[model samples]
Target chain A: MIDSRYKEMAEVGLAIRIKGLKKVYRLGQIGGTTLQEELKRRWEIWRGRDDPNTKIGQTARLTGETFMALNGINLEVRQGEALGIIGKNGAGKSTLLKILCQITAPTEGEIDINGRIASMLEVGIGFNGEMTGRENIYLSGAILGMTKAEIDRKMQDIIDFSEVEEFIDTPVKRYSSGMFVKLAFSVSAHLDSEILIMDEVLAVGDMDFQKKCLNKMREAANVQGRTVLYVSHNMNTIRRLCDRCLVLDEGKIIFDGDVDQAIALYMGIEDHLKTEYHFTEESRPYGRFSHKLSIERTVIEGVCDDPRIGQSYNNPSFGYGGYCLPKDSRQLLSNYGTIPEKIIRAVVESNDTRKKYIIDKIMRLVRMAEQAGQNSVVGIYRLSMKSGSDNSRESASLSVLRGLIDRGCTVLIYEPSLGGLCPVEGGVLVAEAEEFKSRAGIIAANRYDPCLEDVKERVFTRDFFMRD
Target chain B: MTRNTYYLDKNVHFKHISAERKWIDLRLGEVWRYRDLILLFTRRSFALTYKQTILGPIWLFLNPFLTSIMYSLVFGRIAGISTDGVPMLLFYLCSNAIWNYSSSCVTSNAHTFTSNSGLFGKVYFPRLTVPLSQVLAFVIRFSIQMSMVLVILIWYWAHGQIHPHIWALLVIPLSLVQLGLMGMGVGIIISSMTTKYRDLSILVGFGMQLWMYGTPVVYPLSQLPDGWIRSLSLLNPVTMPVELFRYAVLGTGTLQPVSLVWSWGFTLLALFLGIIVFNHVEKTFLDTV
Candidate 1:
């Protein structure tokens, strides 16, 4: 059966021939069941008892509830062809790549491949941080299926390509993130395999590196006569690199043929279904409060003016701060260079205004407590941006703490993940959780936890969402 | 057109890659082709492990030496376990060196799928290469630790404190290979099992500890009450190698013919089962793991 399939595939000059490729993944549990559960299920089946969990007419082969990641995918690729697979998240693009790489087997399929495959599904897959760049090149080369002699022959080329020759002997732990990706990509690009499979390797690094990678891939497919299977969300890169493309949706091939039409089909479906919006007065109220404030313009532009100064009590906190928003807003600002924009710039400034507003709020609370004749220690509950996380990077809580200290309030911090190790400079590290709760007159938290239930009355927060 | 034809004739080879349902597909040729990868993995592990350490490879020898000293103090003096007339240091060191090789091989290989899931999920090489490379790395470390045992043996031989057995030379190599294969087999099985049931991975550590006690590591097989317990210890694949090492060097261990056969049988069986499961798991483990 396989010999006949191979003969037919070879006659067509096909590099890859896949038929009826299906991958059904069992949800929730591993291996479908525990040993006891498996034995009991078998026993129950033997005794002619139907498992209530098993759907009627569902094949006995599917032991548990399954999701078909790739359902009956049939495709063929001509030799030296560059095939781009485009799909949204959970559309089985990665699952197809995983199967092609032979990292995971399809639930049912016959895949007749004509050449050695080198897949760069993830860059730096086995990079030891302690190993030097030179060592990592060989290790990653071997991992990508390059022989030792092959790596030795191409070592200089890889180093030159990555442009990190000076730091080749330095441990990769010391290398910048960009340098690491450069070295990883260089090794992968140097793999002398007959077929190359890649998944979004261009997503990392700068535009220059991305261009270099794309050029190298183009060389691999066009110059070297190697078959290439590329998966990416970047339609421009897809059009540039691929002659043929496959559009996948919910584990089935929705469109297959010209790259442009496939991308258009994918975009048309995605763009049309996306939630539409209009900037009317009614909808303007639903706009982010920071953007609304920027539109209101009570706070003057380019004046370091606090946007929160005259805001009504309904405005909950200044704006989102944690890890994502500030960075995203700044990135958005960078993208809008020379383009006229007001609200984009204001959203970035609103975070600073919010911190200053929080400082003012803490000062008022401290004064209120002092006037009522109580100790005025400000307890900062959780330095983490979110509850149950140790990440304090760009945390609004830390900024609030710093602001409170600048206003001359003794700050007590309660961060469980840090234990007794306080990261803040010149801040009191409260070792005991209960001691922190008892010492402070007012406790300020970015997000509320049920642990603060007893002191809920004393706690001050603008957490209206009750989520991260 | 001629050049293209020549290139196709030379490079093209059709393969039917599919979901295999068979119990075993021992692709030894594929493994052999990627022999360079095995060596590189071994080198990478060896180099990366001791890269930043000041002691470097010296720690390999120092680790077992310190472990044996502690074992001698506890088992020899404190607990008063007999080494069956062998010197306390030699017995402890011999068993420690051999046990370290076998146990580390199993422990490292058992985590083969879990620890290297990131790498395994990206590339395709013979999955056997990973556990095989781990076994080879452990062998290199074992050789270093073995040399230390040899140095102590020479010292003991010089003082006429211990007699050397010629048969030990033959038994030692055989036992070492047996121990390695046993470790590889058991490790492969655990690695495959843990890919699905992660709870098995945790149990493996505790199981190895209990397994050490069951084997004749600190105490000789002769020291155990000559009944079901002794016979049970003999049935353990690890016991044969530990006893054979002691019997070969010191010429003082309960080396029964039936037990040796049983040990060999168990090792081969475990290894056979391991390869079957490993071959089965490598194909689909990415999805489950």
Candidate 2:
């Protein structure tokens, strides 16, 4: 009857029909504090105060943002259809399956399902550890919403299928992770649900198990006439299991039609002629907990292998110079207390620095650069901490200035920090930040701040996110 | 599409679970649906306990016997606590077996979230069933242990070392109710709390150890020196079952009928609250845990 309905819909040009699908996760950990917050919010709503922040997307900048993982995705599925979803992680493939399974409630969405849904999200999820393999069978059955009697009927078959008959008496805790995963997977597959939602569950138990899982999926889809939504990182699984595809990038569907085309799109096989680096900070979005910042106009010079003007890392002469910000300066300071200024500067130096711990020893790099023999003036740039507006740094720009001065080359101050506190004792003041770039052969920055965007060729610094 | 093998009777009100009359009927239906799996779990629980042991199931009887002897000597002789004129060894063994059944269930149930987190993360099921099966398995073990106590009691009765009361007939159903209610109630409560703070799981082990002293397992209520100690001993829910058990079996102590009734009321209340909290906690436990 369901199949006939699907066929009828296809005859009238409807494959899958979805309307106004939305999912929202209320952020913040559920704890005692959350309980208090819930009470407060409920009391406010009861009193008709509106809480001021009750509106959707209104509390975006608070402790947690209300993220719309999926936004109004409407689609139709015909009698026989396979769809593949591709995205660079966090594109909401897993979320869609979870919603279908009703494992979690969507903040807003309506799903009309015509069949039972089975999910192979992970193995050993419905298992009882204290119970032996035999006892867990009953527990697992109840977990799958099957009656105890139903479990009794299926007991022999499940044991044989799992190939864990010998170890059935042993508690699951003693089982190796691999054996446990296999048995759990076997149980899930045996469950006779019509609609299957699998989320990267195949990447377990070794190569044999993986192949078996794929075969099982094929059997469920092709032989059983069951509809399946499978999510995986393996492109080959997508190519094999899926008939059509939907590509999701940054939480939005980028392409949806052909599986082959979707795979190609996912792999970045398409051609684009723009020579400039096409990057958007929002493009590489990680989860809410991780920081995502953008840095532009990084320049590295002074080394013999420095790149030609406007060249990328691919160029032969442009030896890729990447630097790490000293991650825990506070901890390092706490460990050593306050060391001499020279020692602190050397310890926190990024790769571009040529400094020795003691003043008696001269660095080979400085000697080499001096031997190159030009009236080379090195420009010193901004030195600051990680983010926000703060500048209590053991400044590396000062190191470059000092190093250049020690080597008998002209040094310049481009920083206002110098003017306010320790004004350049010996170096010339190139008053204009822009003018300093043209005058100096090398511009060394403690951080790749955005202000030096034009003279990117002469800039040498490591600032992955410009805010730092 | 294959012809449907599964069938639901129209007369069966599948959604009406609130009616106590229908509870067993609906549960039976679900039990029939999952019969094969429950058998699997029950068998698994039994077999796994004895899996790798050299003596295997023999340890089940030996565990309670050894514990009983230790408690009897420590509490019966040195402390001079009367076990209601019953053989101290037999009395402690009977009470210890029941307490073990209930306490094990509670401790295991407390760590339900932390221990089964891996499984819960992956699968869909009525999470209660895992703990339920554990309680059942513990019940089975308790049955075996009780048999040992029965054999010792019959021997002592024949030799005239102990007297048996007609109230002892009530012990069977009373023991079942006493153990089950306490286990289910305490188990659910601990399971709910342990999800958020693992401190409860750690505390349960030590708490159970100290709790034995408060119950009449090692000492009779009459052994209390005075008012506060006697009153405090009565407050422990376990005191009722132990005292009732001693009275029914040995017929040597005053059976405070009112206190016993109060204990029953408390046990039921605890069980009721436990179920409610467990149901609520199970819904959103995954998000927090």
Considering every candidate listed, which one attains the maximal TM-score? 1
What's candidate 2's i-RMS value?
8.5
Q: Residue A457 lDDT in model 2?
A: 23
lDDT (Cα, tens digit) per residue for candidate 2, span B2-76: 111123243211110110111111122433454455455556668667766899999999988998888887888
Worst 10-residue lDDT window for candidate 1 chain A reads: A291-300
lDDT of the structure predicted as candidate 2: 0.55
Give me the runs in candidate 1 sitting further than 4 Å from their true place.
A1-7, A28-63, A273-468, B1-10
Model 1 gets an lDDT of 0.68
- The candidate that wins on lDDT is 1
TM-score of 2: 0.60
Among all windows of 10 consecutive residues in model 2 chain B, the one with the lowest summed lDDT is B13-22
DockQ, each predicted model: 0.37, 0.16
